[model samples]
Target: MNVYFLSGLGADKRVFSQLTLDDQFIIHHIEWIKPLKKELLSHYAGRLVAQIDTTQAFQLVGLSFGGIIASELSNIVHPEQIVIISSTPTGVPISKFYRGLVKFLLLSPFAAPLLKSTNSLTYKFFGADTPELKTLLKDILHDTDSKFLKWALIRMSSWERKTRAENLYHIHGSADRLISIKLVKPDVVIEGGGHLMVYAQAKQISAILNKKLKSEEY
Candidate 1:
């Protein structure tokens, strides 16, 4: 089976560099496309569906904001399963405080630049503790498109799904600061893992994924 991987907000395929899966499964990374002005999340997801080869059997694996995109895509395309790492199954996980904050930032002229800048606060929020991890985080942030970041943040803030997608598997990090564990009930919880746990705890997460992806049950 083929598995399509979607990276977090403003991130690329590098986010899944550390993950290892069985030889039987082929992996493909879904690249982010430019969003139309004021496009709805559902419509944006519809645009992304052009990248997938739906003729064959496949699954989806998304991280952070990409997870939400995966959920939206699931509604449009039929995937065998979808696994979201360090992410929530529904929009309820995004609190009202975060929504208000995004709205406030959208009005500010400095929002895009500020969000694209790599800083100590960004490191702490992403839990980039190791030197290599910090550098990777910095590079990802530096390379992110400011417009896309702002647009994604706005879409995330207003996402309104109330139920989980079918055959969806959620893996959360207990120590994730950006999305608190208290906000969601995940299928698998990585203890001491942070927002970047997919990279930091690749070995453990990879093992879990291999098992889940290979199993008959979703």
Candidate 2:
């Protein structure tokens, strides 16, 4: 099976480097394109899906912001499986803080530049504890395209889509700072995991994926 992988907000494929997928699955990293002026989430996802080879049997694996995109993409073309890490499906209960942020703030039009400074506050927020992980986060942030980041951030903040796909499988963290676990009843939960658990708890996540996704015949 071929699995298309999407990264987090302002992040790239490096975030999934640690995942150990089943031998039968091949990984294809999806890239973010520049958002059209005031484009809707579904419209942007339609553009993104052009990169996928819809003719083949495939799955989708997305983390954080990427998960949001995956959810929308699922509507365009049905995938065999959609495994989302550290993310919530659209219409699921979102935290009060997030709701407030979205309701009060104007998103999409805002632009977030690639950050050069890897501040301690940023590390604490993302749960990057070790030096290597911090370096990894820093590099990802540095490479992120500002315009696309801003566009995604805004769209995420104001998202209102509420639909579920049958093949969607969500994996969340108990200690995730951004999205509260109380708000979501995920298929699998990583105890003491944080927003960055995709990298921090890759081993455990990989195990769960193998069991839930890979163990079965698609």
Candidate 3:
């Protein structure tokens, strides 16, 4: 069997570097494509769908925003299993305060810079306190396009998945700052884990996948 990994926003395959999978499965890393200047979610999902190889059966594992994309992709082609890590099935409900904050940021170009300056704080919130991890995260963020970042954020805030897929299985961190664990009921919850749980708890994820794949074969 083949496993397709969809990395989180502002992240690449390197985000899953700690993962160790069994030899029974072939791993394929899907890279994010630049969305059009102003593209609809359906259009973006369609483009992502085009990247998959429909000729072969495969399972999908997606993290954060990538999980949302994976859900959209699953609508196009049924995967043996669809796993969502540190992600929620529903779009985050934006409160009035958050809406105002988003508008404020949009009105002030300097807002992005201000937010960038707080990277260390963000790192702490995500439990990435180690110097090496912080440096790696900074490098990842540096490579990310601001426009894409804003677009993805807006998309996620406004997006909703109406379809409750039976194949879907969620694995979340109890302390995820980005997505609230209270808002979601995952198949598995890792205590003390944060937004970047996939990186922090890769071996556990690998083991879960291996077990799931084995059970499916029987």
The clash count for each model shown is 0, 1, 0
TM-score of each: 0.95, 0.88, 0.90
Q: How many backbone clashes does candidate 3 have?
A: 0
Candidate 3 per-residue lDDT over residues 1-218, each given as its tens digit: 87888888778998889888788888888878888977766678788776678798888888998898888877778888888988877666678687767756754777555544437677976667677667767777777766677677767776767665658888998888878798888999899888887777778877877777653563
**C-alpha lDDT of residue 126 in model 3:** 65
Best model number under TM-score: 1
lDDT of 1 at 133: 88
Q: Model 2 over residues 1-218: C-alpha lDDT tens digits?
A: 78899999878888988889889777899998888999999999999988899998888988998888899998898889898988888755557688667534434343243233578877877888899789998998888777676667667777777776668999999888778888777888899998888888889988887776672567
Model 1 misses residue 212 by how many Å? Answer: 0.8
lDDT of 3: 0.78
Give the lDDT of residue 74 in candidate 2: 88
Better of 2 and 3 by lDDT: 2
